[model samples]
Target: MEFFVEQNSVVRKIWGKSDTVLFIFAGASAEFALNKAVDWLYFTGKLPSDPLGRLFSTVSYARKIVFSSKDDANKAIDTMRKIHATVEENRGAVIPDWAYRDVLFMLIHYSIASYELLEKKLSDAEKEEVYNVFYRVGRRMGLKDLPISYTEWLPVRETHLQENLQKSHYTSDLFKQYKKHLGPIRFKVLIESQKLVVPSIVKKLLYFGVFSLLTPVIPMYKISRLIKLDWVLKSILLPSDYKAQINELDVHSD
Candidate 1:
């Protein structure tokens, strides 16, 4: 069967690891908090109640599309579109176009950031492939004004970062929820990971010198995975309940 993303794509390799997935969500959590339209998520109350689970569900759907037949992948995309449309209808207003772009761009930027942090740098070709896969998803969802190529996407991504993010009460409350669920130490690590992946504008806005302390460990994570001691790091890093889901991230066929 034909597939939307190639079987051996870099996007598959990136999403196939649990650690990278967690980091992607960590960065997304930071941006999600800063998003002006974050209340759209709050309206459902899912993000506040169980942020990890909510993010994991998104990860799950993403993996499903990456691993499925082209037809099946399109079906999953359709399902996502219908879900968002239903939410908008129920709320009696459309989700903003820029807000939709923000979510899509977050995935694109963080996918590159998280993978490169844990793995080696991706070739420009691999980066283009990553953009292409998600660009297809954006098109299938009927999103307009998406960048025609990955090169064009860079400026648009930057523009979105500048025009779209800020610190608000939602930001504070969401971080509180992160701390409540992750405990203090892990939550700090989450924030540090956010620092590593977020755009420079966001980095300056949410400055903390403490995050630099975690920089040395990024390479160490790569080393541990190579030596099959990745579990030791995960045990120390990930919440126990989410360990299984991380393991499931490795389910893509070799």
Candidate 2:
């Protein structure tokens, strides 16, 4: 069977790990708080009700597209588009064009950022491959004004960071929800993890958050990995029930 994405692609290596997916959502959680369209999420009540569940649902769809045959991947993408359309119909208005682009951009940025953080930095070619996979998804979703290439996307990503985000009431409320759902400790870990992945601009804006407190742990994590004890150390940090689910995120190609 022909795959939609290559068996050994960077996209596969990145998304195949449950840890990377969590990090991706971790970075997204920071931005989602600041997004102007966030109230739309409040409309569904799903995010406030169960933020992790909503995030995992998105991760599952991403995995389905990455691991499936070409025909199945396309079908999965179509289902996502129809889901959005039905939401628009229910709301009696279209989702903003920029709002759509923001979600696409977040996926693009996090895919590259999360992988590099968990593994090693990607070469320019590998980064471009990451962009192209999600760029194809964005085009299929009919998103507008996406940059034509990864090189072009850099400044566009920066522009979106400047133009599309800000602190709002929604931001505070969402973080409170995250704290409520994750409890205070894991929520602190989430903030620290986002520090490692989010753009410098976001870090600047988050100047007084948990990142500083967690910086010392970085070298310790590296040392743990070198000694082959990182998995045990990191697993202790996560909720017990999620440990196996994370283990299952390893690469499995069609």
Q: Best candidate per TM-score, number?
A: 1
For lDDT, the strongest prediction is: 1
Report lDDT (CA) for all predictions: 0.86, 0.81
Q: Candidate 2 lDDT, tens digit per residue, 1-254?
A: 99888988989988876667878988988888788888877777888887777776777788888888988988998999898788889898888988888888888899998888768899999999988988888887888888989999999988889988888888888889888877788888888888888887777665635445556876687677669786886576776656666666754622
Ten contiguous residues minimizing lDDT sum, candidate 2: 205-214
lDDT tens per residue, model 1, 89-146? 9999999888888888888998999999877799999999999988998999889999
Candidate 2, which segments miss by more than 4 Å at Cα? 207-211, 222-228, 240-244, 251-254
Using alpha carbons, what is the TM-score of model 1? 0.95
